[model samples]
Target: MEAEDFAGAAERKAPHGDRGGEAPRTLPREQLIGRLTQLAGVGNIEEAMRCLSEYVGASRFMLARYDLLQEQGLNFIVTSNWPFDLVRKISGVLADRYSRSTELEKCIALLQPSFEDLPPECRVPPGMSQRYCSLLFCVGRVRFALLLLFPDHMILSQERLREAALLAAYGASFVEGRSQRNDRDFELTEREVECLFWIAEGKTSDEIAVILGISRNTINNYITSVMRKTATKTRSEAIAYAVRNNLV
Candidate 1:
């Protein structure tokens, strides 16, 4: 899908007014933090995301792997309440944006909320905004993005959005950490996981070496180590294992 396709689709979804519904209630920062902390303690990532989304006045939420957006299928999605069709329609645009960005640009986008207009073909729930918000965060070597759909004419709080992103990251880290503990025998070093992430992005060893500023041979060695540790026969199988285990 070309970038122009997204622009044309989004243009048609714009121009809705607020329907005078009661505003979403806002929680005090301290209380919000406390609630999020409790959710994180129990590894309830879905609830944590929902709480944050509501607090920030969004009607829906989608948590996805930023590094795996380019991959086909919804396997990269961790959790979401978005319409399945909407997700499928916009995934290509999101992947295009991710691929065009440099590593430094992506790192700079961490925890920063960005809004994008929904495509025309997407039928958002009544009273919802045509635009959606997204923010990125890292949990270990893996990066995740939280996408939100809000109401029309609602002004979202930037501070709360940043806080929500951080809290979401904390919750995700807690869950990912617990999962990793259960697979301690198959643990890969941080470098190996980094390599896995790039390979999953469809980069060759030489390209990954350039991106990481390391030797191609070193990159290959890392992949070799990852394969051995995961007991996978090929790079494709290793990447599959990483995705299944949420190691990337």
Candidate 2:
């Protein structure tokens, strides 16, 4: 689905409250599960995201591809209902953080929800929180992060947040699965993709050899094969190509 379809879909007025505006009414666990189940059958990523946002009392949602965060432009963004300006400002920060994180840290972070304060210069909407929530999940080999905005000082349910993340992952699998099936031009092997992932994480051939429990020369061979298949002359270029195309 196109990003424009849901870019501003979550900008509706909030419920009236003493503190300017109230948090969106959160869905109970059972109801949330029911809503997500129905959304799964509908196969609409935007709606599923909106449902999860509201179910967790969030005001806005931006679903982005974690792997492509380091790439230039907004191609990393899968779908978002966050403001265009805010997205542009925050994406660079997220990319920088992703680049600094180890590969193991990223894997352990999957399906976990974390919070971060917005950049000081960002102009948050009235009654919205300065801190935002982010949850990561994987669909096959690809990883995605769901960034959320909620009302100021609003306490969100941990259980619901985790549940929402899983449902979001489930919803995304359908969309991404279909896309992968139709686009098979890369045809990189699993081992080759593994090498690309490590190299992207800044691992040298010798380091990757130890990590994968293979010979250094074997690791070099895998790198060579990846470069050849991806038509990249250097290791950096191959990793760049892999990041851009979400091959790793």
Candidate 3:
């Protein structure tokens, strides 16, 4: 979904519980589960992005998957704001520097949240602005982030942040398992299942290949086979399916 679409959607869903601009009531655990369950069922990526966008009360959100290789930068599974050109440019810039910060390091190493000040390498083009942006958590092998745009300094309560993180984690898992069966677990080879688990943890294909002692192409092939068996279109969908089915 385009960033512009967020404003309208927020207007429709907003004023629900806002106290002088803060969320009036934090989503209860049951509500959160319901929302995430709904998200798991979304067939369209935009619908999922929009679901996440409103849930977090953010003007924009992005789920970008990064590989450790110096050359192949980040991949955008879903983006709410930040223009395409900017995302490409900033992703390249952020790739090398992410490893330096403790938050980024923890996020990459242990699937933790990197919710800190924006990395210096993230360059906003002329006329662009943001207030708070954070790497919330990683799901499987993907890093999911929450970016709050300018004029909206969302001082997320620790409880709310924690809850959002948990919900985002669920979303990550759901996206990670998107193409798996809804009723039963998809039958995947040992390597494919291993790859699926790590992908949910945000590992790159090369990482999986190395861990499995196989070529990257072979790793990709396994993923492809899994996706075919599950009948998913994108890797995100496959992961979502896996999450829904509790495959990994």
Candidate 4:
């Protein structure tokens, strides 16, 4: 906290670095969208992100796919301007945490932007914020997370960030060459989740029928559908799947 310390910091600062005193330029959301769309059209994730970094005043960008069922990180990743060792060390933690949620939580999280802190070891330029803005989505059986780190003291409009989340989904789809990851709810129908919930509560099909004012056969059919969709052989197995996936 000495005056010399502040002077020393200024001496070390480079022009237009992530934390340099000079402010980064901001763009209109419409213009940003148009540019990202054009950049993404080239079918290059890195290229789109290179432009994104300049706009967001961030040092890096990363897209990670997480497998919620397996509790592991998928092989898919696109990053710019990040250290290799840092990515390797923290990618798993980042992926796991973002992808870890119940079916209900996933349902509510759609397109909702949020922030999280990185590990202390993940270095940025002096005074750059260590926070990451995350946007999560799902495709078929896979879940994808887009992360961006903004420079310290720079104010980014949340409106633009939300649009960035949606556009990032498109960019990811373009890069992965597959559209639709089976939808964010994993294609689980409402009645199916209801059945899964009741079963997880130790309810027998007959009891559920009485509570739901449906025939026993209909309740059995719902349970059957849940098992088939989840690929579980037994009611207990199906319920376990639901619980593990945070569905119930």
Which one wins on TM-score?
Answer: 1
Clashing pairs in 2: none
TM-score of 2: 0.79
Per-residue accuracy of model 2 over 34-94 as CA lDDT, tens digit each: 7766775566778888988887778899999888888779998888889899999999999
lDDT of 1 by residue, 163-186 (tens): 778888987887887775237435
Where in model 1 is the C-alpha error above 4 Å? 1-23, 181-191, 201-203, 207-214
Candidate maximizing lDDT: 1
- Model 3: CA > 4 A from native: 1-29, 68-74, 99-104, 107-129, 141-143, 146-152, 180-248
lDDT of 4 by residue, 109-224 (tens): 66666676778877765656676667677543346666676666545545455566677776666655533243333877887788777776557888888878999999889888
TM-score of each: 0.81, 0.79, 0.51, 0.56
Model 3 Cα lDDT, one tens digit per residue, 171-240: 6676566655543353676777777777765678998888788899988998898888788888877777
The lDDT, on a scale of 0 to 1, for candidate 1 is: 0.79
Worst lDDT run of 10 residues, candidate 2, spans 1-10
Off by over 4 Å in 2: 1-43, 181-187, 240-246
Looking at model 4, the pairs that clash are: 102-246, 103-246, 139-181, 140-181, 140-182
Q: After TM-score superposition, what is the CA distance of residue 198 in candidate 2 from its true location, in Å?
A: 2.2
Q: Predictions ranked by lDDT, top down?
A: 1, 2, 4, 3
The predicted structure with the larger TM-score, 1 or 3, is 1
Full-model lDDT, candidate 2: 0.78
